[model samples]
Target: MDYAFAGAMSGLVAGIIVCPLDVVKVRLQNQPPISLTNYNGTFPTLVRIAKEEGLKGLFSGLSPTILSYLCDRMLWFATYESFKVAISNHTTRKLDDPFVHSGSALLSSVVCVVGITPLWVIRTRMMTQNTETIYYYRSVSHAFKSIIKKEGLTSLYRGLIPSFLGIAHPLIQFPLYERFKIVISNYEHHSKLEDYNPNKRPELSNLGILTSSIVSKFIAAVITYPHEVIRTRLQTQTAPLNKNFSNNTSVIPNIVPYNGIVKTVKNMVVEEGWKSLYKGLPTNLIRTIPSAGISLWTYEMILNNMKNI
Candidate 1:
């Protein structure tokens, strides 16, 4: 219960702080291939959004983002803590072992992805909508209804495969965090390695948690980022209108809508080159590093306080 509460609070604060960067990242990722020159890059995209859409533009989809974070983080921490406890109790191995941590993170992520995917899809679509394009969603509830009515139930799960692939993120992140904790502990103890105690959770300093989270998240994000682009593209695709049906039949037939993971990857590479897979990496790193650091730090602090009380 305490873990779940702490996680929800951490996610809420982190989501709010990083929402503008998230908005920028999504816009960059979901931009049409031809419009790359218009947005140019991260700062230019931020300026464009602010100039054209006002300050509100930076916070688009904040409602859904907050809600998603609340539920997703709650479930993730609860399940992860539960898994760690179960693994420690059942196995002879230490709970802080790399494999144990990674396995727990992977399992927790699976459950989190399954439950929170639709909310994330809704958030992405809302964030990417702009005045230059036809608005697909007026609001979160409206988007949910419209997607169901127009695109069918399965549309909400469009990016599930790539999201599943994203499990590698926490697989890398948690293990690195454990390793960093070990290094910090050894350093503090004058070069003597200490075994982690499963019964007593060691309190990590704020700086240690922040530094570890930033390093781990950055590396995990860079390696796993292509899947993020694919997932956003999958979620934000809409059906085209027939306004240009009479203009050019050839163009109409050639318009490739985002399909599944493999088809989307093939089409993206063919149309925009392999570099397209990493379109919004800079903005994503900016958003994720601080957001992840603050979140982990906040989660640990809250959990520590709860344990003391």
Candidate 2:
């Protein structure tokens, strides 16, 4: 419950603040690799979206984004702690064991990806579409219904495979964060566990945590970025538009949808070059790394205060 509250509340704050960047990132990602005029650069894309679609377009998926972060962070933090405890108990190792942390993060990632993938699919659809697009979702529920009705029930889980593979992001991130935080906490107070307190704020540890979170999230996002591009492409791919995919082709018609993570990677690389896998990496990193750091920092800050209260 403590972790849940911290994760959800902090995620809400972070999500709202960083949603505009996310909107641009998803747009960049959903576009074809060789676009001359669409979603060009981070700043350009932001201006383009705002100019063409207004603030509503800039914050296109805010509602679903908030819901996704709430469910994602809440489940992730809670499940991570539970998995860490269970894994630690099963092993003959302490809670701070790197192995335990990585394993716990991996398991928790699985839970989160499976639990809230549909929300993400809906969110992606909402983010990518605009008023001029073929199907702009009226609302979150409307998006859900349109997808399930027009595409089918299974379409709600469109990017499940790449999402599963994207677990590598947290598999590396959370463990590194845990290890870094412990190191910083110990170094700050001159003892391994003395500065570590649930019911009190650690002295002089906020900056260290911020640094650790930024570094960890940056590395993880870069390493696991291709899966993100693949996932977005998969989620944005809809069923055939009236028995002929070519005739009434959408804006990004040049992008051929491919299924299976490895096959998609192969096809993308073979057809569009290796850069295709990193289409929106700049915007993604700019948006998500800071957002992730903020969420982590906020989570720790809030959790400590909650415990103290």
Candidate 3:
């Protein structure tokens, strides 16, 4: 099986299905810092976006998000497979070695972050801004050009630091996922994982993979979610709006541009409390838990069928 092809399909499926939820999550994350708008919960936020902005609102960043996943997952799985193969060959370690999974995923994440941060910056802007704002971007390419023109080339990689920090997510997740696969295989008395095979054992079925993905993803997400909020804020955040605007009648939350990660996080905690750091957690969980499971399941299914063919 072509790991690249399998990963690409997995990303496309997951990105499209979870995009609406992603918009909600970003809006929630972006809003709290400035008191722009308050979102109550996941379902409520989804309902509000649909009611006010319609389907287009829900899918605002669809193009960039889709492209992001396609490129990200293609690089991710391809790199992982290459790293896994190389490490196992050199060290004579089993393919399932924990270091193999963790190292591969972390390296793959770095590759994705470097390659894809600009897409994410564009996506965040598209999601948070409408036609009214100076930052609103119509198409992905327009956003790309506009950001560079207006804010300079570095703007496209605004949240790059936190994005690199986000590697911790897949590092924790893929390794734990591999560990879980080993557990399931052992539980079923099967020596090899069903990662690319569905007929070996019923215990290592789709359900097992799904469960592993959900548990690993959920854990990783919970631990790493604050970085997500910080990253979004940095990406969509506008320049410091009217330094003396605090004395004015109305003040926008985008008043402060998040500068460094530590300063931004410290500011969020001081101003909005620690909860602000986890602004979109519930929505994120709802969107991502199943999304991860589905992504892995899709990749494995594609790989399995392709191998059989």
Q: Compared with the true structure, what per-residue lDDT tens digits does model 3 show for residues 1-309?
A: 399999999999999999999999998888754453567788998998898889999999999999888888888899988888787788877677788778788878888899989988888888876434444566899878766655579978888999999999999999898888768756666554445332232245788889889999999999999999999988886444443333222123466557799999988888889999989899999999989999999988888888779
> Taking the tens digit of each residue's C-alpha lDDT, what string does model 2 give over 107-163?
998999899999999888889886546576777898887767666899889889889
Worst 10 residues of 2 by lDDT: 245-254
Q: Write the per-residue lDDT of candidate 1 for residues 1-309, one digit (tens) a residue.
A: 999999999999998998889999998888767663357788898888898889889999999999988899899999998998787677766777776798789999999999999999999888977665445566779888767765578878878999999999999988887778767755665554555554556556778788788898988999999999999888777544344332211111114588789999999999999999999999999999999998999999998888889
- Per-candidate Cα lDDT values, in order, are 0.82, 0.82, 0.81
Candidate 3 Cα misplacement greater than 4 A, ranges: 189-203, 239-253
> What is the Cα root-mean-square deviation between model 3 and the actual structure?
4.7
Candidate 1 TM-score to native: 0.91
What TM-score goes with each of the models?
0.91, 0.91, 0.89
Error of 1 at 53 (Å): 0.5
- Sort order, lDDT high to low: 1, 2, 3
Predict model 2's lDDT versus the native: 0.82
- The residue pairs in collision within model 1 are none
Off by over 4 Å in 2: 33-37, 192-204, 242-255
Q: Candidate 3, 309: how far from true, in Å?
A: 0.9
